[model samples]
Target: MTATKLKPTLGTLHLWGLAVGLVISGEYFGWSYGWGTAGTLGFLVSTLLVAVMYTCFIFSYTELTTAIPHAGGPFAYSLRAFGPTGATVAGLATLIEFVFAPPAIAMAIGAYLNVQFPSLSPNVAAVGAYFVFMALNILGVSIAATFELVVTVLAVLELLVFMGVVAPGFSFSRFALGGWAGSDTFSPAAISGIFAAIPFAIWFFLAIEGAAMAAEEAKDPKRTIPRAYIAGILTLVVLALGVMMFAGGVGDWRALSNINDPLPQAMKTVVGDNSAWMHMLVWIGLFGLVASFHGIILGYSRQFFALARAGFLPPALAKLSRFQTPHRAIIAGGVVGIAAVLSDGAVNLQGMGLTAAMITMSVFGAIVMYIMSMLSLFKLRRSEPQLERTYRAPGYPLIPGIALALALVCLVAMVWFNPTITVIFVVLMVLGAVFSKLVRGRGAIDPQLATEV
Candidate 1:
């Protein structure tokens, strides 16, 4: 398979937009589910822990991104450190994380739209979103990146607006009510609840590292990636904690815990149901979901194109269009996401909706990818000591060590709490291994493509 190159059109601002836009949706909706499992206070502890993990992980992960500057991101890092098998595992995990995440964000987009148009079906709206964003991604990287920047800025401003509008109503008394896992004092149950809420807390900063996939398209990537990643994580951490705290304090936190539109509900308590601010939360808030949905489309397509170029997936998917974009790969991922949206009611787990289940599954892939990425960092540090690294992870081994240790704890907690999802994830990994083995047996592997970066 011939290696196709992505155009160098993204700069630090575009990279920052992609990094934050790819995850800003988490601040909009899914993290509220953590409140259901761990109440406000318990979930707060969970969020803090996960935030620390992401901060350290991004710091360490930047070393690999700058040295390699590959569109394959984690797959390329692992390939350089390990071999084809490691690359295959990382590729599959990344595919799952990027592909599954869009469908969940799409559903959130649809739900927000449905609030305005009561007659619209959310599933239909979700599939429509897949069609529209995939087209935008296929047009060109610069256009897509520009759109991502505008929407991300709008999304970030809306969150700030939300906080300002609701601040007058925020009270410590309401926030502390049932804060410790529904108990006045912390206990073993509260500890268990914090562990169980790990996946939800992780939802906050899940895809910030996806910007690494755009490094090949970056001008002077080594300088840009670190700036984008560090700034993006810091921005997300502040917004996430602020949004969660204010949302919880404005009303009965339990009331906002189980729903998709927690921000709107939280705003209702402060401004009433018919207030302009409440409407703004539902309307402008769509930008957050749109930003994430559009950015992930770009992310997943690049991963698909990179995998296909490296002979892990069908080479046909690596073909560039007249516009010099991975049109086929973009469409392929959209098809998978649309199919998931169509099968919404058919596959339900633990009495949760398809969106929640998809979030858990995506988090499963993200955790696996994180583990492989950190391990790759350590291996490359020892094996290729001469590799050009424009940015080195601060605190060396200790920072990444904390990230890896926290990721392992979260993975164990997720597997214990979501046994069915764990089985499904394992089956997917096994299938990926089998496919890689068969491709190798047929002599379809391309060593040149693996080292293209």
Candidate 2:
């Protein structure tokens, strides 16, 4: 049977929405967890370092996305630069990043909702969210993207409202009262906390690169993709800084640092617990989680479909539905996410809580993808100088070099600080390699289709 292709229907707006929506949830929750690891001051330093890495990474990654313009994102770039093995590794890492992230976000969503409705169980709510969003995704890409755009716009506005509400209470003195959180100045413990905070700091901008995965379905990807990526990253940087500063400044950062729903908790300090603003935050904040949860589902589906179409995964996963959506891939990813949520009890390695542990694993995947994609960018520039390119990364070698170096540092920090998750990541990589080899050995992939895009 012939493979069905994703419909090209997305414009720059949809791309922007998806890009922002895929990561907007970070503004609401995960990054605050960094405060628990490194305290306010230490996490701030970590955030600054991570911000630099992502800025450089996005600029460099844009060139690859525009030049290649495939749905595989990093996988496509690595496939062109380093062949199938590289593609497999990149694809698996992308899967780990995209697939694992939603469950964590879903848990946050449940926690936010449960605060509003004391009767609701977080796990049940999380599972329900998966089903609802997965169904929305299978409807059609345009419809799904339109939903993404709407919810993302609302989510962005809510964050601004949050900043405004909390701004009146913002106090530099309060923010710094326990900012260092007992970590000695320049001591080994302080140094270790900063490194350990790297993953949570990365939570601020983890999946912004997922924008490139929609290239195949985006209108004029060369122009649209680059613009969306640049615009999206800038928007996120502003929001991340705004939310972090205001949230910590308004009240005790320590109180909300380890919670799944930090924004609502932080807002509670400025507006009393019973205030309308607090209620608004809990209810409206759910949209932020939905935006990312839905958008990432769109992203991982495309990544799965691309890898399958390229012969790296089972051919069935590349199959499209009557609506021209990657229904199989979407369902497959949903299954994995649901399984992660259900197995939360078993997967809470290192006592970081399920959400934190999952975030660590996702960050681990992201670092690998970043390192490989940057290497692929360098390889492609050296090996295919004459290839067509509409846009080149502004800083070229310097930007990509900086990104690569930082990604390596983050990887080292992640392994050193979170050994349990690191071991799990290694096992996942090995399993992926074995599965890829077995599938290829069976001649299950169509060579013609593999090279089509």
Candidate 3:
């Protein structure tokens, strides 16, 4: 468990990149799926509600990240507040959230590529992404972070370009067509659709909290985390709403609802499929997916390294490579994601495609982790009042309370709508619990590591 520390090479900009990049793929593809279930206006309502939760959650969660400054993130906070069992839940949830997310983004990356190259297979591109990014991560934290910053900037710009290109064709009349759960007027079905759309709404900001996993490697985390998180959330809110509205307005919103590459398809409606703008969006759009996919690899590997270092998982995963990166942990997560990628079509859930199913499962883990994180924030406030908190959550009880309540509601809605994915998530949690218990009983964890947390 005694491994080299993660190098502190990340600053405010790098943290912002990681924060936004971790969830930017949501802007590109997955959130549009909400359109399928909720229609344009219904999914817009869902997005606004989830946006409030994340805005509050990030503000409150930043307090923990700054105070604890651990690679384990929620796991570390839970360990300090509620001990091993809480840590186990937070750790596994974080793991599941980070691990499952990339495959979804990777699949989107492949889909975006397939739009450009007619014969290319999405599965092949998705699998190829795992190897390329894992190697970049293994080289060094600074290099990985610098690369992340570059791609994140490009992705942000591409989104802006997309909005500009589609603005001329935007028609509120078109967007409102079947906008309320496939109905002109709101009804019981609209309510159900909004609830069912919660997971996809959450997809818009799912891994923003994963930036906390980089706390251990951040320069002056207490100062950097707040600025990065607040700015990142604001940036995403603008992009998510803009992309969804503009895309929905150009022609039939329903056409873009269920597919993986919504932006390109939406753009094709304005510019012909052969237009230069269409080609550019397809090419640059990959950066959005690549940003999230690459960033999540960094996020999940840190969780694996942190859990293993704490003796909650295999000790071998804690080892750092010559580059001071958690190479083993990175590869371990990549293996799981690649497996999910390979099983894309083989394991279908209801009528959901592999990407939609994975997005739901990832959101399931995220909501659990969000609830646990808010609980930890409350517990720590009461138990460790003296702990140095350079940045306090602005509203205290109100802000975190809102975050916790909304997270619970999202969790319930997701479970109700996606029963099969819920069962699979629960089973994974149970298996992780058993594994953690066996690992702990063997006294495999270092007492020093426990004391440090």
Candidate 4:
């Protein structure tokens, strides 16, 4: 049977804003900054390479975005490039990255705020942030996209201004600080210990492709989604490279050695006791990351909605609002969020259910999805030679091949670097596979129910 066509509804600016704001400055960079600062100069250099690798994989995603330009984003691309089962697997992997990221970002809001008001309970901050984000998301995506655009602009402005302020003040000598073969952390088992830290370095850009998942809702998705995906990735390149190179130059490794904070430590040195202005800057940057997470939840909900509608997940999740919004899917995403908040004192999930845990599962999922996407990019080029592409992936075979290689390395590194989370990720993948079989055997995820969602 010929597949039904579904287009996404986001515009260029909105899609780009959603991609850039949430992915570049969101929790990944915020958290990675802290982790990077804790390591030595050697580790910092390697971390920068990871940032480079992220851009490489992004080239692959960008190609897919331009080619498919449909609602399911990666899933849809894979479906067209591969098949249904492949699409579901890709969707699951993409789902892993974000399903927990929003909650984690909300928790980070509490943590970042805690730096100022140590006594403010994380529970209150998380719950408050979650509800606000939820409201923005449910109000229809355009509102959230606009908010993200504003936040992304502010964030990019802040980071750029901060870098400019520090640029002329930089000293190249400070980056010569020492470290071993493994990352900055030293022990008999240093190789794995340092590899374990790779994710923290790469995490900054984890949510970059999120907008693609919501491509169905993107206005003129073919045009909008591709631009958004590229712009979002470029945002990361500017932000990550800007911060890394800028930090290494202007900030002394001595004061920054014990601290994992890029901006705080830099502010302390440069601003030097200008407590008022530094606090203002830090909070703005921090909150910007927190606020942008609305994009992540937005993407995840749509993916689940697509899955449900396509007969993979529970059909009830495919319900739409009067205005055609996937109200049920959005709410279902939020419900898990409420549970996550209530689970372990609000912030505990950031540790237990986050990057080293569920979030890293997302990283693994992204790798799997990315590799498939690379293959799909290649296949589509051959399968539909006549299909139009706005932004063809530069270097074609070489670009896609490198992206696939980088994806494999990162996955291997993730496993070697983070065995504990690695095991959990494999277990989850197995479960997803098993569940896929179970759902298929059940005959259309619930055949008794009407197909009227």
Best by lDDT: 3
How high is each candidate's TM-score? 0.98, 0.98, 0.99, 0.84
Q: Can you tell me which runs of candidate 4 are displaced by over 4 Å? A: 1-9, 26-38, 165-170, 179-194, 248-262, 272-274, 341-359, 443-453
- How well is each residue in 210-321 modelled by candidate 2, as lDDT tens digits? 9898898899999999889999999999999999999999888889888898888888888899999999988888899999999999999999999888777888988998
Q: Give the TM-score of candidate 4.
A: 0.84
- Kindly give the stretch of ten consecutive residues in candidate 4 with the minimal lDDT sum: 346-355
TM-score winner between candidates 2 and 4: 2
* Overall lDDT per candidate, in order of appearance: 0.91, 0.90, 0.92, 0.65
lDDT digits (tens) for residues 217-331 of candidate 1: 9999999999999999999999999999999999899998877788998999989989988898899999999999999999999998888888787778889988889999999
Compose the digit string of candidate 4's lDDT tens values, residues 187-288.
544444356556666566777777776665667766776666766777777677667656666666445432223465676666664566567667777746
Decreasing lDDT order of the candidates: 3, 1, 2, 4
> Candidate 3 on 360-413: residue-level lDDT in tens?
889999999999999999999999999999999999899999999999999999
TM-score of structure candidate 1: 0.98
By the lDDT metric, which is better: model 1 or model 3? 3
In candidate 2, how many Å is residue 339 off? 1.2
